[model samples]
Target: MSAPAGGRRAAAVDPTTTVSRVKAADPRGHWFLLAVGMVLLACALVLNGYVTNVAGETQAPAPATDVSTPELDDVRSGGPVLNLTAGAASSAGPAARTVALTFDDGPDPTWTPQILDVLRRYGAKATFFAVGSKVAQYPDLARRIVAEGHEIGNHTYAHADLTAVSGWRLRLELSLTQKALAGATGLHTTLVRPPYSSTPAAVTLPQWQSLRAVAAEGYLIALTDLDTKDWSQATAARMAKSALPAKGRGAIVMMHDSGGDRSRTVKALDLALRELGRRGYRAVTVTGALGMPSAHQQAGGVERFTGWALNLAQRASGSLTAALSWVLLAAGVLTLARLGLFAALAWMHARRTRRGRRRRGIARWEAPPPVTVIVPAFNEEAGIQATVMSLVQTTYTGELEVIVVDDGSTDATADLAAALGLPNVRVIRQPNGGKPAALNTGIAHARHELLVMVDGDTVFEPATIGHLVRQLADPAVGAVSGNTKVGNRRGMVGRWQHIEYVIGFNLDRRAFELLDCMATVPGAIGAFRRSALVALGGVSVDTLAEDTDLTMALCRSGWRVVYEEKALAWTEAPTSLGQLWKQRYRWCYGTLQAMWKHRRALIERGPFGRRCLGYLALFQVVLPLLAPVVDLMALYNTAVGDPLPVVAVWAGFVVVQALTGWYALRLDGERASALWVLPLQQFVYRQLMYLVVIQSVATAVLGVRLRWHTVRREGTFGGTLPPQAAPQGALAERHPDAAAQP
Candidate 1:
C-alpha cells in the first residue's frame, strides 16, 4: 500500500474487515458473559445486605391472645365457619370421617422427594403450601407434586408475615408467589396461607384485615385447625403426637416438609398416616375434604409468561453465582502467585548483585573503541538540539560520531542539528518513514562497528556512552540496555512513571539478565553490535516494538543481552493521562505482536525458546489479562465483604511492593522519597496501565492494525544538556536562502 498523506502509511491490512469477521463469528457471547457477571455481583451485594440486616434484628414475640384454638362445634359444623371474615376460611367441615393434611415451607429437592415417595406408597393425598422462591428453584419438584394428584398452594414469596408487613408488601407477596407457581408448573392456586397464622380464632386484627383485603383479590385465606409444631420437635414420636386430630373431628393438620433437615418430619409423616387410617379416617387434600373448589387451575396467558420469566431468572442467577465464585477464586490464586514471584525474583536479584560485587572485587577501567550514535527523529524539533548536544559533550576519550536521521519531519529538526556545525555531527534527511525505517537508514550510513540507538527526546549523562560500550568487549554480548529514568518528575503522572521505571522495568531487567532471558533492550537507550543488527535484518518493520523484536532475534541467534546499570539516560515521559495511555497502548500492542511473531521459539531447544518464551507467556500475557479481575474483586470485597481483611491484604501487598521499590532505588542511587507515591499509584495509575493492556489484547484479538501514535514533546530534559554555539561559517549564516525553507 502507498503511504497516506503526511508521509504516514495507512495500515496494510484493513481493520474493518478483520473486526467484522470477529463479530460475525461470536457476536454476543462476550457481551452476555459480562452482563451475567455484573448482574451476579449486584445480587451478591443485595443478598449480603439482607443477611446482615436479618442477623442484627431481633424477632418480635407473638401475642398471647393469638394462641387460642377453634371451637370443636364450629369445626364439626364446617362450611366456611360463619365467625370468620369474608376473605378467610377455617375448614371445609366435611360430614364424612375425613381429615386434610397440609405441609408448608417446601419444594426442597432433598426432603420434598422423600415426602412424595411416602405419600405415593400409601394411597394418601396432601396439600403443599410452598414458598414461591423455593418453587422457582426446584420447578421439577413442583411439577411432580401436581403430577402425582397433590394440591399446591401459595405460601407467600419469601415466607413473609402478612400481619407485620404493609398492605402493598402483603399483596406483592401473594402476587409473586402466584407468578412463581404459575411459572414453575403452569398452574395457579386460590389457597393463600399467611405465614405465622394457624387457626382463624388465633389470627390478630391486622391479619384479619389483610385476609379480607386478599379475599378481594380472589384468593381464599386458609387457616389450619391442627398445629403439629414439627419445626421445633426433634423426634418423630413427638411430632406424630402433636399432629393427631382431636375427638375424630374433621380438621386441617399443619406440618412442615422443608426449612432444614426433614428426616424427623418424614419419619413422623409415615406414622401419622398409619395411625389416622387405623382410626377409620383417610387423609385427603384441603379442598377435597372441604368440597370448596379444586385448587389446581391452569395459568392464564399473562401468568404463564410471568412463570417463564421467573424460571429463566432463577436459572440465570444460579449459573451466574457459580461462575462468579470460580472467577473470584482464580483471581485470588493469580494475585498471590504474582506477589510470591515478585518477592522471589527480588530476592534473587539482590543475592546476584551481592555475589557479583564480592567476586569481581574492584573493577578495572579501560578506554572504549570507536562508536556511532543514531538518533531518529520525526517532528521532534523541540528536543533534537539538546539530544545531539548531549552526544557531542560526552566525556569518553574514544572517537564518537553522531548521525541524526530526520524521518520526514515537517519541522526544523534537521536544520537545528545542522546549524550546530559540529564536524563530528551529521544530519541525514529521509522521506516520511516510521522510526524503524529511519533507524535502518542511519544504520546503513553508520561508520563504526558499534552503534548506539537513542530516542530524540532523550538526554544521556556524559559517561553513559562509555559505560554502555564496555559491555560489548565480551564477544558473546550482542547488545547492552542502559538504565532509563524520567527527566520530568514534577507531576503526579511523571512521578508514577519514574517509580515504575525503577521498580517495574529496571528490577525486572536485573532478574532477566541473570537468567539470560532479557526480553527487550528499550528503544530509549540501547547499544547494538553492527554485525548482530545486520544478521537480524536491521530493525524489523512488522511490529511497533522493533527494539524488542530485534532483541529477541539476537538472543535467538546465540548472543547475550545484558543491562548496564551505570549508563543512565533521562527521557521525557508523557505528562498527561491521554498521552501516557496512547504510548503504553502502542508499547503493549507492539510487544504482543513481537511475541506472536517469535512464538516458534517456545519449542526451540535453547534458553531463548524455553525460558524467555515461558516468561513472556506467564508474566506479559496471562498476568496482564487477569490483573483487571483482581482489581474488581478487591473493590467487591471492600464494598460487600469485610473491608478490614481486604484492606489488610491490600496494604500488605503495597508494603511488599514498596520494599521492593526501595531496594530498586537504592541499587540505582535514586531518592527513597519516591516510594511514598507508590501506594497512591495503585489507585489510578496502575489501573490505567492494566486497562491499556486489556485494550491492546482486545485489539489484537480483533485483528485490528493500529497506526503509529506520535507524542508531542515539550523538551522536558532541555536543562540537562549543555548549550551549543553556532559555528561562524555554518549553513545558516553562509546560505540563508537554503535554511529558510520549511
Candidate 2:
C-alpha cells in the first residue's frame, strides 16, 4: 500500500496514523454503512409505524396486550433448533425452587385467545412464540394474547423449517419475521426461538452471519426442555390430562394458539395452571421462573442494547483512553528506568554521530565502542560456522570481535568456527551449562567493552550486527535488541511463528520503545555494555528467560534498553506446535518468573516493573490467564445461546497490531513476504500465546519448574500448532550472504 520500493509515495497510512485517517482508510467502510443504515432505519421505522397503525384488512391486527412476544431474532427453523448446546455453560450449584413454561409454534386464531383467557383466569404468565403469518391474519387475536400479560417470541412468518434455508435464505427468514413482527406489534424483540432448536444451519457460515439474519441483534434463543405437543389435535379432556406436568420442576409446555382449532390446548392450559397452583406450584415468566438474569447488562449502562455502529463509537473513545493511559504509564516507567540505560546510550550515540559511519545524517552520536559478538553454541556443527561468518562480514568498523563459545559440543562447533579463519574471530570451549551459561562464558572472556549476544542457529544481516552495536553507541542506551525473523517461515508453524515474532515481539517492543522502557533485549540478537553485563552478575541459567532476565536486570540497574528495529536476525521458528508450545510456555513462565524476580520495580525502585498501572498489569500478568479464559468464554458463548463480542474484541487488537507490525517489518527490512503472516497471526499465534500463558500459569502455580530439555524436531511446519504451549525450535543466526547467495 505504500507504493512499493520506488514509486510515487501514495497516500499511505503509517503507524502513527490518527483515528481520522484510520476511519477513512478502514476497508469495512463502517461510517458509510452506518449512515446508510441510519437512513434505512429511519425509513423502516416510518414504514413500520405506517404498517402497524393503519393496515386495514390487508395487514394483521396488532397483538393483544397479554400475548407473549418472545423476541425471535434467529427463528428460521424448519426443524428443531438447539439454541443452547449441551454442557456449554458451567454451573456451580443447583436451583432451590423454580419453574419455566414456554409455548411454541402458535398464535393461531382458535387456540391462542382461548389459552390466554384460561391463563388470565388462573392469573398465570406464559411465553408465546407466534408465527408471522398467523399473527398477520389474526391481529386482533394477537392483541388479545398480548393484553393478558404474557411474553411473545417470533416463530418466523410461517413455520419455515430452518433446514430448508441454508445461507442468506436462512437469514432472510429470521430477519423478515423480526422486522414484520416488530412493526406489527410495536415490540422490540430480545429473545429468539428457532422453529426447531441450537446451532441453526443458517449461522454456520460467514455470509449468513454478517447478514446477521437471526443472531445479529442482542437476542437469546429459548432453550426448551419440555414439549407438550399440543399442536396435535386431541380431545379437550385428553389434552388436559396429557399436557399437565406429572413431575419435574421446570418445563417448556409447547402449545399452539393458531393453526386448526385449539379447544384441547385451551383446556390443557386451564388444567395445567390450576394443577400447578393447586399443587403449591407457581407459574411465572421465563426469567422469573429460572430466577436468573437472562441478559448480563453491563452494570451502569444508559442503554441496554449496543449495535455494531454504537460499539465502534464507544470503543473509539474507550481505546483512545486506554492507549493514552498505557502511554502515560509506560512513560512514567521509562523515567524510573532511565539512569542505567541512558548514560551509556548517550555516550555511545554521541560517539557514532561524530564518526559518520553511515552516510545517514541525524543527531547520531560518536561511533560505538569496539563491540564483541558472543555466539553461544552447543553441538551446533551445522550452522555455527555460518553464524560466525555473518558476524565477521559485518560493515561496522569502529571495532568488533566474534567470540564463539563452543559450550561442550561433541560436534565440530569449535572446528567450524576455526575453519572460518577470520583473524579476530575467537573460539572458546567450556563445559555445557546451557545457553545462558555459554553466554556468560563468552561475556567473561571477551576483551571488548560491549558484548553482542547471538545464538548459533540464527542467520543475520552483516549490517544487523553493526546496527545492533550502533544503537549501543547512544550514551542513553544500555542495550539494543534485534528483531527475530522466521527462517522456515515457508511452513505453517513457521508462518505462524513468523507472524508471532513480527506481530507480537516487534509490535510489543515498539510500544515499549515509545514508553522508553523495553523490558527485554532478547539474546536472539542483542548488544550490551560490559559494565552493565558485569553489574548484573552476567547471564543466569536459573531462569528460562535468561535474556529477559538480563534485560530487566540492566533496566533495573538504570540502563535504557533500546529495541534496534534495524537489527534483523533470521532464526528458525518452531517447526511443530508441540515444540512451539514448550518454547512459548517457557517464555511465558520465565517472564512471570522474571517479573516475580523483579517485582520490586513495580512498587519500590527496582526492575522496570513499577511502570505498569492497573490495566497494563492485567495485560502483562493477569491477562495471560484471562486470555485463555476469554477464549473459552467465546467458545461457550457461541456454543451456548450466548455469543461473546468476538469480532469486536479481536478486530480492535488486530488494528493495533497491524499498525505496529507494518512498522516493525519496515524497520527490520524484512522482505514483504513476512507481512503475509500478519492476518493468520490472530487465529493462530495470538491464540497460541494465550494457551501458553495459561499453561505457564498452571505450571507455575503447581510449583513445578520446566524440564531442562525437550524433544525438538527440525522439520517444516505442519497441521495446527499442536495444543502444546511450549518452546518449539532452536534459534540460529545465518551468515549475511548465506541465503542471499542463492
Q: Pick the candidate with the highest TM-score.
A: 1
lDDT string, candidate 2, 1-742, tens digits: 0101223232321212111111111123443654584455433333232223221012222222332212222333322222232323111111222345566666665666667767778778777777654455455665665566667776655465554455565565455555444444445355566664422323333322322345544455554544566666566666655545555444445566655656777777777776667766666666555554432222112221222222233224334434634654454354334322433343343345445435654334365457788898777766665566656665566677888888778877788778766799998877656677787777778888877888877656756766676566566677888877777766777777775676457656655655556777776788887766665566755577788788777676666787765577766566777788777776777777777787677775532565533323556555554444345434433543234455665565555556555654554445556666666765666777766775666666656666544325342222112221111223223233322210
lDDT of 2 at 741: 13
Cα error, residue 650 of model 2, in Å, equals 5.3
Q: Estimated TM-score per prediction?
A: 0.80, 0.50
Cα lDDT, model 1, residue 146:
95
How many residue pairs in model 1 have overlapping backbones? 1
The C-alpha stretches of model 1 lying farther than 4 A from their native spots are 1-99, 158-176, 194-217, 226-233, 301-306, 361-367, 395-397, 514-516, 606-656, 659-663, 723-742
**How accurate locally is residue 511 in candidate 1, as Cα lDDT from 0 to 100?**
77
